[model samples]
Target: MTMQTRVNPEVRPGTPHQMGAHFDGEGTNFAVFSAHGTRVDLCLFTPDGETETARVPLPERSGDTWHGYVPGLAPGTLYGFRVDGPYTPDRGHRFNPNKLLLDPYTREMAGGFIRHRALYGYKVGNAGADMSYDGQDSAPYVPKSVISDPETFPLDATRLRRDWSETLIYEAHVKGATMRHPDVPKEARGTYDGMASDAMLDHLTRLGVTAVELLPVHALKSEDALLSRSLVNYWGYNTVGFFAPEPRYFGPEGVAGFRRMVDRFHAAGIEVLLDVVYNHSAEGDHLGPTLSFRGLDNASYYRLAAGEPRYYVNDTGTGNTLNVSHPQVLRLVMDSLRFWVQAMGVDGFRFDLATTVAREAHGFDRSGGFLDALRQDPVLAGVKLIAEPWDIGPGGYQLGQFPPEFAEWNDKYRDTVRRFWRRDRHAAQDLGSALLGTAELFDKRGRRAWSSVNYAASHDGYTLADCAAYTERHNHANGEGNRDGHHANYSENFGVEGRTDDPAILAARQQRVRNLLATVFVSQGVPMILCGDEGGNTQDGNNNAYCQDNPTTWIDWDRMDEGLIAFTAACSALRRAHPVLRQTTFLHGAERTADGLRDVEWLDFDHRPADWSDPALGRICLHLRGSGESATGNASTDEVFLAFNNTPEAAILTLPKQGKGLWQHEIDTARDAQASVSVEGTQVEVAPHSLCVFVCAGETP
Candidate 1:
C-alpha cells in the first residue's frame, strides 16, 4: 500500500479549553496537554488508519495546552500527537517526537496498540539504558485518537438511582460474561451488544442483581511480557486510554455499542458500574514502552521518585502510579469521569487500586484531592462510588477510610467468611463482625451498613466453586511458575484436589459454595456476586487468570450448574423480599422501640446468649429484626433468623419466641432448594458445614 497525503487542510489556532478532538459539525478542533513540550504536531491518518495523511503543527500553546483547528476534519477523522522537547529521563523530561502519543481525553480510539521495538522511546539493549533515545517513528504501532461528538451517541438521562441498602451488585467482565452464551448472536458474542442481549439481561434480572459492576472496559494494551508468552491482559486493567471504551468489545455499531448497552441495562432496572483504572497508565516503568503518558509529559502524568525522576512510583504494582495530585492530571481524571456519566450513561465507577489515586506527598490521605473531588462533584456525588481501597504501596489498606459517599470492597468480609466456613481457628469472632457489615472498620464516620460491599469471592481470586474445590492456587498457566497469584487463598478441596466423581465430595463442595453465597446475601451490606459463581464456574484452580484470555477466564455456559443457579436466585430473592436482611443502619445489638426487641441478637446452639469469647465454638445463630432507627424511612417489621454450623456434626438450634408468628424455613445451604415449610417447633437441626435461614411467617409482635 502506498502512503499518500489525501488532504493538506488549513490549520488555524484553536481554543484549548477542551482537551480532546471535538467536532462542531463543520470542522474539528484538536487540543492536547503537554506541560514541557516545545512543539506539538497533530498527525492525521487515512480512513483505514494505515497511511499518514498530514502532520499539521498545533499553531498555538496556551497554558501547557497545544491546539489547532482543521476546517474539513469530521468526527470520524483519525489523529494522534507527536510532541518535541528534551529527551532527558533523569530530569523527567522524556519527550520524544518519534513516538506517537494518545490524547489523554480521547473519547474513541482507532486501531489497537501493537508491541514493537519502535514503541519504546529508548533504544532496546542500549549500553546507556534510558539515556539513549531511539529515533524511530512509532506512529504505525500506536492507536490513534478519533475526533468524536458526544451528541453523535445520544443516551437517556434517566438513571436507576437504586438505594445502596437495596442494591445487589454482580461483578462481571464484559467479554468473559457473554463470550460463551449460547443465545447471544455468534457475531455479537464477546461484545457490548452481546452483554445487553436478551439472554444476558434475562439472566441478570433473574439473578436479582440491581447493578452490574463490570471489569475494566477502558482501552488497554497487552503488555510485552504477556505477548511474549502468547498471553494477553484479559482483565483490561492495563489501561492505555482512560476515556475510550475497549475497542475489542465494540460491535458493528462501534462506540455507540457501549451507550446502547447502558441504555438496555437501565431499561432492565440495572445500573452499570465500571471498574476503572485511574491509578496508573499502561506504560510501565523506566524501561517500559512510551505509549501515551510517558511520551506526552512524563513528569506531569506520573509520580516520579523525588530524588530519582527516572524511576516511577510503583504504588499500583503496575510499574507507574498516576500523578493525580497534580492539578492538570486531576482535571483529566475528573473530566473522564464526567464524560462517562454524561455521555456514556454509566451509573458509577469502582476505582481499581483506589488508594494509589488518593495518595498525596505524605501517604494515603482520607481527604485527598481525588477523593474530595469525587465527593464534591455535582454529577458524581449522587452516583455510586466504590473503592478497591488498597494498593501494593505502604499504608495502602484504607478499607473504610474513604469518604461517606464511597462504598468499599470489604476483603476482611471475604477472608473471614472463607476462614469461618473452612473452620479456621479464631475465625468465628471475625465472622460475627463480617455478617454485621464490619462495623469496627466502617462505622466510625457515621457511615451506613451498606458502605461495606460484601463478597465471598471476586475477580482477582478463585471462584466460589474453586474456593471449595482447590486447596492451593494452581496458577501455573499464568507463566509465573504458580507464583503469580495470592498464596494464602483460604481454600479447600474437601478430599480430592481437582475434578472427582465422588458424590459425597461433590455434595460437600456444592454445599460449601451455597453456604458462601448465602452468607453474602444474608449479611447486612450491599452484596456483590462474582459473575459466574452462582452457576459453579471454575478456572481449574487458576486463581490469577488475568493473563489467560482463553476459556480459563471465560464463563462456560455449557457446564452451568442449574441447581446452584436456582439456589443463587433464591438467595437474592430472599434478600430482596425481606428488608431486615438489607439494613441501612448498623445493628449493634441495640433495642428497637417499635417491638421492644433487639435489632440483632447473637445466640448459641442451645438458644442462650452466644459465648462469643469461646474460641472452640464454630456454630452460632443470629436473630435479626428491623431497626426503629433505620436511616431508611420505611423500617421493615419483619424478623429473620440465621443459623450457621461449620462443625463436623449438626447442631440443634432453638429459635427465639419473641415474635407472635410461626417461623418459616426460607433457605437451607445443605439442600439445593428453598425449604419453605413452616417449623413445627422452636428447635431445628442445622446441618454441618451449612447455613439456614428462617423468617417470621404470619405477623410481627
Candidate 2:
C-alpha cells in the first residue's frame, strides 16, 4: 500500500502553519483540503503527463483538511488526487476515483486539455447520468498538479511597485498580442516570454503605456458545449486554477519560464495586471466534468439549488457559480489573490464578471468578503483594482456600484458615445454627462473621476474598425451560427458593410475612428484603448472573435493604418498634456470673473445660450477654464477651450476672447491630413463630427 499511514480528523486546526506541507527545505509534506471526503488519495504521475507512479492516502486529517508528509517528494513532483467517497450527485457528492482532480491550490499545471471521455467522472452511456460511477482510470489524460516550493523564487527577485493613479493599462492577450509578431523568435511567439521581451517593452514604452492588463492568464479549459460547437474560448473567462498561470502561455517550458517573464516585465517600467475569472470555473454544470472544485466539495464550494444540491445556481451564466459566501471558499480566493500579488509580482487585477464575486445571500454586496478583503489588503490596496462590474446574474448590471478605490469598465460611456457619433437621434444630451464621468451614476460616492474606465472598444465587443464598418455583429467565425455575441452593438457602417475601395467611405470611416478615440481620451475618465485600435485593426466584423487563435485576431503590426496610427499617437499626447481633460473633480458650472467668463459655458453658433431642447443644436462649444495653478490645490489658473461639432456640416463658434494669450492648437481630428490648426479669434469653424482642443500661447500645458 506504498507504506500508507492515516491520521484521523478532530485533532488540530486546519491552518497552513499546522499543515504537514510545512517542511524545512529537506523534503515536501503534502497537504490537500477536502471538507467532505472520507478518503483522499494523492496520485503521483510522471513528468511527461503519461504514467501513474503511485497513489498514497494522506495520513493526517485536521479540521477539514487531509495531509501527509513525504520524505523524498519535492518541488518537481507531478501529483493529483482521487477523493474516494459516494457517487451521489443528488446530494452534491460527485466523488469517483476514476476521475483525477487538480489541486485548488496548485501553483502550476503542466499540460493542455485533451478532450476525452476518460476526463469525465461518470460512465459514457447515460441512463444513470452522473449518478452512475465509472471504474476506468483517467490518469492517462488529465493534468497533474505539481507540488510547489514556497522559496522557488527569491524574495527580492520579481516584485514590481507601480502606483494605482500613475497606471495606464494596456489591455492585451498573451497569445493574440504576439501570435503573429515578426520580430519575436518563432519558438517564443505567442508565449509569455515573447510578450515580456525587450521588443514588447520597447513598444509599450514608446506608446507611454504603464501597465499591461493581460486577458485571463489562469489555467482554463474549453467548455464541452463550446467544443461541441467547434468553438474555443480565447478570452479565457473560464478559469480552472486561480493560482496557476496558463501553461500554454508559459510556452514549451513551464513555471520557470513564467517566472522569467515576470522578472523581465519588472526590469522594464511595465507592470502586469492579470484579468482574473473567479466567478466560475471551466467545469460548466452538473453535466460538466468532475474537475477540482466540483468533485472535492461540491456542496460547499458552489451555490446549489435550494432543494437539489446536485443542481447548481447558475448565476454566472456558465451553469455553475462559486459560493464565495462560504468561509473556506472565500479564503481560497483571498489566498490565490495574495499568491499572485506577492509571489508572481503582478501589479494588479481586472476582475472578469466581478459582480459575481460580490454576490451573497442578500444581493451583490459591495462589502462582500472578496471585495472587502481586497480593499483592506495592504498590497492589493496599493495596486490598481478594475472591475468588469456586471455578469449574467440577477442585479448584475453594477456599472458604478464598486467601491471608490476601484475603476469600473464603463459600458454606458462606450455605448452612449458610439451612438452619439453614429448620429442616433436623442443621444446628444447624454453625451455631456458621459463625457463628465457619468456623474448621474458615479458622482455621489467618494469616487474620483478615474472611477469610470471609458473605452470605445475592448476585447468583448467590436473593434474600432468594425464599429465603423458593421451595423450588426458578424460573429459567424465563433462557429455558433453568429449567435454568440451581443446583438445591439449601436454601430453604423459609414456607407459599406465591410472593407471598401471607395475613397469617400474610407475617409469617413477614418474620420469616425479618430472622432471615437478623441472622445474616449478627452472624456472625464481613465480611457482604455483596445490593443490594435491605434492602427485600425479589424476582426472582419466578428464582434466576438473569442475562439480565434489564428491571425484573424492577432494584431497586424506590419500593415498598420498610417492615418489611424498617427491620430492615436496625437490623441495620447493630447490626453497626457492637458490636465483639464482628465480632472479629479467634476467641472462646476458658469461663475463670474473666472477669466472674465464662466469656468465652463455652453454655446451655440451665434454665441448664445444653447437651447437644451433644440433638435437643431447638434453642435456646442464647451469653454473649460481650470482653477488649479499647480497639481496640489484647486485654483482657476489654466484655461482650456474645446469646440465640439457633431453636425454633418461645420458650425462657426465665437471663441472666448480674453487672457491676452493666443489659442495654440492641441488636436484637431477633422482634416484629411493629421495636423493641428492654431487660430485665435472671436469666431472659429468646427468641422463635422470633430472636436478640437486649444491651449494658451506661451504656456506649457
Candidate 3:
C-alpha cells in the first residue's frame, strides 16, 4: 500500500515578502506575500473557464509568504488568489476580494480578455469616492492563470559566447519577419520554427551578422484601444507574461517549437537575443481592467501615486511603470531573464526601455538590483546585455550611463551621423565626436569603444532610404488624423517627397545610403544595420510603424536593388577586413608610431594636420596607419588608409607615400567600379559624399 499525505493550505512569506507560485512534481504550491492582508483565499477554476471548482483558505504563514498546496492539483490547472488587506489609500494598500487575480508564475494563458465593469475590484458607481466595495464576478471576464508543466520545459543554459566587439546584431520581428516569406511553409510561417528554417538561417549567414535580436517575443496582449480601433500591437511592447513565449509565435508544437528554433540558431553559429520590455504591461491605469499583477499584488508591482494607491506612475509613457524597487518584482525580472537564457538556449538580451527596470527609491541607479544581479549572475554575466537606456521618466536619458558590463544604443551617434551627411551646419564637430566612438559620452572607467552601439536607422524611425527621402513623418494610415509620430525627424528629402522618377534624386538617395553605411562601418563602435536597409526598404515615410504588420514591415526580398546590395556587401567586407574600424580600445591623441608611421592621423583638406577650431571646413580625411595589431584579435592587421569627403564639391586627397609595395584600392564608395591598384604616391580624387579605403604592404618599424 502506497502512503499518501493529505495536503492543506499553508501561508508564509516569500523573498521580498510579496507572493510567489512554486510548482512541485505532484502538485503546485501557491504562496502570496502581501504584508497587510487580513485573509487570503485561493480560487480554483475548471479548465474550460465556466465553473468555480473550489475556494480554499490559505492556512500556513511563515514571515510574509502565505502558502498553500492542493495535493491533487496538477500542471495545466487554472487558479487565482483573492487577498483581503487594508483599504487604506495614503498608506499604499489596495487589496480587494471582488477582483480575480493571476498567478505570477503562470507560464501559459488562453483566449482574449472580456472587458467589463466587474473586472475592477473597486466600485464603479461610487458617488463620493472609488473606495466603496462592489460584489461582482470577475472570473467570467478575467483571464485564468495556467500552471505550467515544469517537466516538459527545456533546460536553461548559457552557451554560444560571441565577443561584443565582433558582434553584429540584426533586429527582427518574430511574427512579421517570416509572415509573408515565400520559402517558409504555410503552417510554419509567422512561427518561431519559420524563422529558424534553413531559408532564414542561410540569409543571416550570407549577411555576415553574428547575432539576431528579436523584437519582443514575450507573451503580450493587444491594447483595449487597439482592439476597439481594429488595429493591433504588433510590436508586443505591452508584456502579458515575461516568463512565457508568445504561444502564437510557436508552431503546432507550441513551446517545443521555440526550443527547436533556439537549438537551430545555436547550431548555425548564430546567437539569438530577445528585445524584452519590463517597463510596462497591457494592464493600463486606474481606468484599466484588472490583469495578472494588478489584482493579485497591485501595490507591490506598480509604482502608484504617493497619496492615491490606485493611481499609477506612468514612467514608460505607455500607461504604468513597474515597481522595480520591490524585491519580489526584482526577483520576477531576474527569473524571467534566467529562464530565457537557460530554457530557451538563447544567447543574450536587449532590454527595451531598460531605464525603468533600474529605477530605485532615489532614481535610476547603475547598481540597482536588476542590473547588479545580471552583472553578478554566472549565467547572465557571460551573455551580452544591450540597453535602450531611456524612458519618459524624470532624468531617464541615460545613454552611456549604464554599468561597464553592458552596451547602450547611442542615439547621439545616429543623429549626429545623419546631420553630418545631410549637410547640416556645424555638424563636423558632432560627426567627429560620433566617428571617434563618442569619447565624451563613453570613455569612462575601463569601458571599451564597443560600449556604443552605433546605428543610423533602426526599426523605430525612418529607414535608411527614408532618412534621405523624407523630411516629415508620413503616418496618415495610422488613423490618428496624421497627428502621430515625431516632427523633428532631422531627415532631408534630397529633392522631392515620397517616390519620384527624377534620376538625380534616386541616384543621390542611393549614394547617401552608401555614405551612411560607410560611416557606420568605419566608426569606432559596434555597427548594427537594419534588416532591409541594405536594399533600401521604405515604409512610405511612416516613422512610427509599430502597429503596421502588413507589407510595410516585412523585408521585401523580391524588389531588392542589386546595385545597392553590392555596395552594402562591399562596405561590410571593408569593415570586417580592417581592425582600426572596430577597435576594442579607444585611441589617444598622442601619436604612436608602429609599422613605420603613426597608428592614426587626422588629415585636413591639404592632407595636413586637422585644425580643431576651423569653422568653415565641411570635409576632413581620417588617415589610419595600421598598428599591425591582430585584426579582430586573430590575424595581423593589414596597413590601410582611407579618405572621406562630405562636402558637396569633389576634393583631391594627397595619398601617403607608398614605395616598395603596390597600393590596392580595396573599396571606393565614390564609384560602382571594382577596386584597382593606385599609381605610386598619386593624388586620389574622391567624389562628393564619398569615401575610399586603400590597403598597402609594409614591414614593421
Candidate 4:
C-alpha cells in the first residue's frame, strides 16, 4: 500500500475533550479514546468511500486519547481509524492497522459491511486461529464514518414530555410499522418519512398513545452466521455505531430524515421512546471480527473475564457484555442517550437488558454507579426511564426491582394476564394481584403502580393476535428448524392449531384478544401495546422473529383486523379519559372515604367479597372508585367498574350503589363496538368468557 498520491489536508493538533468527530464550519476535530494503543491513524476515503485518498496520523495524545484537527474537513467527510498496537489475544488487545475501524460516537456512516474475508482481524480457516494475525487491507469491505456536526441540526422545541403515570407506550419497529401501509406512498414505505406520514400519525394520534417506543434505531450490522444464511439482523439489537441512526432506515436526506420524523411525532403531541441496547455492542467476543470498539480499544470497551483476558463476560446473551463499569464506556452510553434527547428530539429511552447497565464487579445493584449517575444527571433523570429489568446473567430476573425512578417491563404482568385469560386454574389470585399493579412486588420505596410497564406481547414474542390462535410456536420461516423460539408458550388454540373456518372457534379467539387488551389498559400501571397488535397483527406464531425482516414482521394493512383495531382504540381512549384506571397509588380493597366506595374491591357471586382461595373461581368484579392523585399530585377523579368472567355460564353482576352517579356500560367484549344506555338499576348480566367496563354518569352516544 503506497501513499504516493496522498494530499496534505492541513492537519493540526486536536483537543481530546470531546469524544467524537465534530466538524466546525472551518474544519473537523477528531478525538477517540484508546488507553493502550501506541499509535492511531486517521484514514480518509474518497467521497464515495470506495478508495482511500490519504492517511493522516493524529498529532495529539491527551491522556489516553488520540486526536487531530483537519483545517478543511467537511461535515460529510468519510473517514475511519486504524489504531496500531500490539495484536495480543491473551491480553485482550485485537488492534490491527490493516483493518479500518469506525468511531464509536459517529452520528452517521456512508456504507455497510460487504461480506469479505479480510474484514476479520485474525486469519480465517487457519490452525493458529485468533492467535494468528492477518495484515489484509479491509478498507474496501468496511464502511467509513461520516462527520456530522451536532450543532447544525435543529430540534423541535415543542417536543412532548408526558407524565409516566399517564404514559401509554406503543412498541413498534419503524420499518414494520409502515412498510405495508397502503396509504403511505410506495417510495416512502419502510422509511422514516412513512412512519411520520399522515396515515401513520393519524392512526397513532387517534389511538391516544402518549408515546411510540421504537425498537433499536442504533446503526447495526448482520451477524456473520446470519450473513452466511443470506439473512439479516432485523431487530437492530446488534449495534455497530451507537450515535448513528441505522443507515437502512434513513431516507434520501440521510440523518435529517430521522430528525424530521421526531419533529412530526412531537408535533402530534406524541413522545418518542427508543428501545436501546447498550448492554452489548455489535462487535462480538474473542473469535468475532474486529469492529469499532473491539478494534479501537478492546480491553477498555469490553468486560473481559477476570482470569481469562481472551474471553468475555457474556452477561447480555450476546457474544460479550459492554464494560459500563469503565468510566469512558459509561460516558459513551450516557452521551448517546443525551444526543437522542437533546439533538434527535426523542423524549425517553426503554433500555434493553437494563440490569447489565447497573451490574458492577459482583452483582446487580440498585445503587450501582450507573444508576446513581442517572439519578444525579440533570439531563437524563428528568426524562422517562424504562428498563427491561433483566439479562442472561445470574439472578437477572429483576421485575419490579428497579429504583423508583424507573418503570420496568413486568413479565409477571404479562404471564399472569395470559394465564388468567386462558382460564388456568388458580390464576385468579395472581390475576387479582396483577390488576392492582402487583403492589405486593412494587409498592414499597415510594414507587407507585405506574412503575410496572404492563404488556401481553412484544417484538420478541408471539403477537397478541396469535396468542390464542396457536398453541405452539411456528417459527419455521426463521430458518432455525423451529427450534430457535420459546418452547413453553403458555398459549392455547381453541380447537385447530393455525386457522379454522369454524365461527365459534374464531369468535372465542377474538374475545380472548379483547380480554387481554382490556386487562392491560384498565390495570393500575403504565400500559404498553405492541404496535400492530391492535390491528390484529400476526407473525404466524413466530415468537422469535428477530431475523425475519420481510412481510412476516411488517404490519399487513390490507388485511388488518379492523374490528380489533377499533376496539383497541376505544380501550386506549377510555384509559386516557378515566383517571381511576391509571392510579399513581396502589389499589386496595378499602373505601376512599367514610361514605364512598372502595378504591378497588373484588366481588364474587351475588356481590359477596371474592373468595380468592377458591381453586375453581372463574369470575370476578373490580369496583374502582374515583380516587384521585393518591392525595399527592393533581389529577381527575373518575370512577369505573370492570367485570371479567372466564366461566362457561353467564353471571349476573350486581353493580354497587356507589352513591356517586348513575352506572352506564362503556365496553362489552361480547358485542362489536356498541354503546349501551345508562342503566337505572344495579343489575347487569355479564356474558361468559367476556369483559365488561362500566362508567358512572355516562350516556350512550
Candidates' TM-scores?
Answer: 0.97, 0.93, 0.91, 0.96
Clashing residue pairs, backbone N/CA/C < 3 A, model 4: none
Q: How displaced is residue 185 in candidate 3, in Å?
A: 1.8
Off by over 4 Å in 4: 1-4, 150-158, 593-596, 628-637, 658-660, 698-701
**lDDT by residue (tens digit), candidate 1, 204-302:** 999998999999999999989999999999999999888889999988677888988999999999999999999998889998999888988999999
Q: Residues 1-701, candidate 4: write the lDDT tens digits.
A: 23438565777997998998987788999999999888999988878887787887899999888999998788778899999998998998888999999999988888889888788899988996888898898888888898886555543333576887788899999999999999998887888888889999999988888899999999998898887877899988999888889989876556788888988998888899999999998878777888788888999999999988989999998899998989999889888888888788888889999999889988999998888888888777568899999999988888888899988999888989999888888888898898888999899899978899899989988898899899999988778888897776668889889778899989988888899998999899999999888978888889999999999899999888888888988898888888888878887776655445467778874788998888767888888876634455543346788888889999898987746468878889887675656876889888998989998774334
Clashing pairs in 1: none
Ranked candidates (lDDT, high to low):
1, 4, 2, 3
lDDT of 2 by residue, 261-317 (tens): 777887778788888988889887888887788778887889888888878888888
TM-score of 2: 0.93
RMSD, every candidate, angstroms: 1.8, 3.4, 4.2, 2.2
lDDT of each: 0.89, 0.77, 0.76, 0.86
List residue ranges in candidate 2 displaced over 4 A. Answer: 1-23, 155-166, 252-254, 590-599, 615-617, 629-636, 698-701
2 or 3: which has the higher TM-score?
2
* TM-score of candidate 4 versus the correct structure, residues matched by position: 0.96
User: Judged by TM-score, which candidate is best?
Assistant: 1
Give the least accurate 10-residue stretch of model 2, judged by summed lDDT: 1-10
TM-score-sorted candidate list, best first: 1, 4, 2, 3
Report the candidate with higher lDDT, 2 versus 3. 2
lDDT of 4: 0.86
